[model samples]
Target chain A: MHDARYGWSSVHRCPSRHSDGERPRPARPGGGLTVPTIETRGLTKSFGDVDAVLDLDLTIEAGEVFGFLGPNGAGKSTTINLLLDYIRPTSGSVEVFGMDAQRHPAKIRERVGVLPEGYGFDDPLTGREYLDWAIGTKDADDDPAALLDLVSLTDDAGRMAADYSKGMQQRLAFAMALVDDPDLLILDEPSTGLDPNGVRTMRENVADVAADGTTVFFSSHHLAEVEAVCDRVGVMNEGELVAVDSIDGLRDTVGGHAAIELECATPPTELGVEALDGVVDVAVEDHTLTVTCVDPGRKIDVVTHVAERADVVDILSTTVSLETLFNELTEGGREGGGETTAEVAQ
Target chain B: MSIDSVLSKDLTSVRRSGALWGVAVCLTMLATMVAYVNIGRGAPPLREAQDAYGLLAGLVGVLVPIVAIVASYMSITGERASGGIKFLLAFPNTRRDVFAGKLLSRLAVVGVIVLFMFVAATAITVAKYGVLPVGVAVGVFAVSLVYAWAFVALSVAFSSATASRSQAIAAAVGSYFLLVILNLTFRFSQVVRLVYDTILGLGENPHLYAAADYVSPYIAYQKAANLVYPAAMERQVFRLPEEARETLPVYLTDEFSLVVFAAWLVVPLALGYLRFQRSDLQ
Candidate 1:
């Protein structure tokens, strides 16, 4: 919403692209909290024959950590580029902080801090110079040392970026995005080129930034990070928004079945097993009883049934990981096995 | 578009780059060495300030083009190749701002190099000949800046137009051959005449070499210099005045050299900016 202290974003106050007879004033300017940090309706982009991103609608709230996930060729980068107005959309509209992205790219960019994927740093700029340059571009007052400190690169801020390692460069990029104390942070593949420790630091930095009332909209193919950081995750497949929900909600989509694997003493019959409460599917294989149970309340009854009927040595309740849910929901080539790496790598 | 922001960023990056500084230092040394040999050496040395000025003019006319090619051949292409332009455009700049900023900053760079060489040339000529010939020094410096501007424009155009640094290099080198070498070398002039007279249906013209020279920006610079200070520079610059040059048309006159320089400055930048603005950087 609106803060008179920040003023109305007068720069992006142009008439919306599809202005009819009368203009509808946006609510964010009226001090209402309904305006999303990023919103897209029927957004589409196509490069020749390939529809990189199709009619997609998305809404990300303020102070929300929205994880945009997709398999390769799922138009994740295309969507990010569209949101940033790097390329013209084939059709539809995008808005960031109640301003149309296409109509007010510069104004949108002023308040939005972005770490675009597939971008490189100036070789001669020291880490400090890079941060200062970003500050200059945003026309915002920022201390280079504090920005570098946030990324844990304060000691190496004086060193040329050419000498910095890949992870260091990514950290520097993250720091540069914080120059203006932006209202929104769009980090595309922020954890890429990082070691395990670097990934942890990135996650912490993201968390710390989000805690300052800045909405963080990040795209990642890495499942666990999204699950850890995102309040909601959107999955795209074949140029379309295929899934959008919380991590657990997505895992619960196909009946929220809880998978329980048991080490059984003997082979179990399927007749009584299928009749058990909340059990959607059951299969016995190689001395293990696997039960897909939908209800957590009936989980104990299934264990009782198994233990009473066929000696259950051990029972394990495994929650479906976001990785598995992602693979199952998106086009991971399970049903069609002939998909090549080119199709997968898009 | 934030032109000031982009220009500052560009200048900051260029100043810190060792390669650019190295180019500047190397070009300065080369200009000074060449100036030293041209005016100070030989039995009956060309000691007149205007004469030494003409010789120094030739020295820098050749030198500035080389430096321009070297300094800007990869100006935009290298950044695009390394995916750095994406980073630049990720800020508040439009693509046009990036192009304008690059042009202004790089022109400033080449301008500094030309200034250094001209200052040193003016100093050495004044020291050796006991006169500054203030008018000639100013004319030559102004002409040299324009000369460097044309080359920088062409180089930056190629840099923005090409997809790769290697292609930019090839374009810069090829442009160097077309504009800098075609008229100076007889063979290149002969080859051009052959292509025009024998290959094309244009009737045999003995003035084809002069026609080629009129189109070349470097030749225009020399012509402009001669037109400005013809009496003093006649014995200064080494050139065989051909009949074709005397009969060269009104449009190809020394005044049109400014026109040529202006086209070289504007056309390439316009085309390059349009392409850079429209193209998908990634």
Candidate 2:
């Protein structure tokens, strides 16, 4: 019911109406606003001579699923560790919820839930007991039984934490993070060892929580998971965030906008739609017209005109996958220029 | 928000499934219950019960190090190994709170075990003699506990700095033995005495033994323990040679050495807490 209300409200609030009568809704006070949940400016960390994270500047918005997409040794974990105050940055500062994180890590952590990668809980306690102990320090309205049920660990809840499988342990960790119903959830490689269905459930759970206006900051090498769950993603390569934007915005930057696929019963002659605005390239494969457009909607009119001449059987659009987009953006190229690619100093 | 909550949680958690409490209790029972050769020959008298004070000191001497080492090693390493340190550190407690809470809990473990054993020892002494020397027994127990607490802090310092349980344990034990052996050798060996006399200029120095007292906390504790014994009172009555007098005051008569040993506890603990606050947990 709440979903419908939000859905309709979002649809009615047109982009132009964002100015005139509305004062941007007074920044939503504390909810649904783009306030920085975590902000790092000129953040640098070094272990001896090796720089793990170098001059990283990032802003993770409140209530947004912010994905830190990076490869191994790309400093995703290091950045998370810095934010958690497990390690002090060699330079610069980290702020969480508008407070200095290093100075008040404990207070910052109280409102944040973190599932650190490869974290192993004590073996003596059962799954339920471990979660209970983990959440004991926080204020919560959860019973271990309900939490176990949510994570689908009702049966295994009785078993010792050591006896849990890798996936089960991961699930239990997720349950532990959810115990406090935290405002900020920081997950480092959250879907590490899960099966396909488990991954789906994990993705759904993350999305569901983020949908309810909890800021989620997660790091993952799996671009598909990031694409599915994150509203905005920052790609980290060699300890620097190279790109930060919505998935669609990244795709457009990397793969040069969304393409409209037109399968016509009769192919148009002379590629007339190529001369149309926003149509970058046009290729006719048998009866299908594959139109690569800088603006998909602009080409939509041209495609419709062409379809009036040719009997159109199918009309489809293609957006670049997160993987292809990530590679192209990080690799650095000049095929299409729309948005400026952001680069962080090392 | 409260330090007691943190300390209470630590104590309860450590007591539940961990082996520290059980080991401490077992060692204390064995030390107090078993008859030692050092306190024997005469039976069923006030003097005999006073003789048991030295035996009780010996019991504490053997048991305190073991408990100190076990509890200290378990304090930080156990939490880190279980990944509970992250959970604990993430709460609304500062590094000072965490360090102090763990230190107090470990000390409390030793205190509880030693107190139980002291009560048992007093009961045994009462059964053998007509009455218990409640004052001496309780004072000795309290003094020994303070001394044990010094080592407990040292062990925790090592535990916080080291990466693994084995490493922490090994470091604690190695340091413990090194101090004891070095102090013992410095006291007995003529070559060492000659070296100290030549290099550190202690040949005719009156304060040579007093300066040497810095090597081990055990010496200070042992001196205090002897003072609580009735034999020590007898020693105080007899006339002694000049060297004996100087050595006796340094080891057995000075109250200031215990204060210095007590400082060792606080300094290492502060260093450990600082390191823990900044050190990466990876």
Best by TM-score: 1
i-RMS for every candidate (Å) is 1.9, 2.6
Query: What DockQ was computed for model 2?
Result: 0.28
- Local accuracy of candidate 2 as per-residue lDDT tens digits, B1-282: 535546767776677755865786687577557423336565646666777776777667656776777767768777776676765665555566767788888888877777777777776777766677776877788787888888888888877777677887688778777655554544423344566787777574434444455446766666666556665433332124476665554333556656667687788887888788777776
Q: Which candidate should be chosen as best, given DockQ against the real structure?
A: 1
Error of 1 at A287 (Å): 8.9
Cand. 1 Cα-lDDT: 0.75
Q: Which lDDT tens digits does candidate 2 get at residues A117-236?
A: 757766466788777766676756678888888889999888887778899999998988887788889999988888988888887788767655677898998887786666678988
Q: Model 1: residues >4 Å from true position, as ranges?
A: A1-27, A31-35, A46-48, A90-92, A98-103, A195-197, A260-319, A331-346, B39-47, B186-192, B200-202, B206-209, B232-248
**Cα-based TM-score, every candidate:** 0.81, 0.80
TM-score of chain B of each: 0.87, 0.83
Q: What DockQ values do the models have?
A: 0.47, 0.28
Native contacts retained by model 2, as a fraction?
A: 0.40
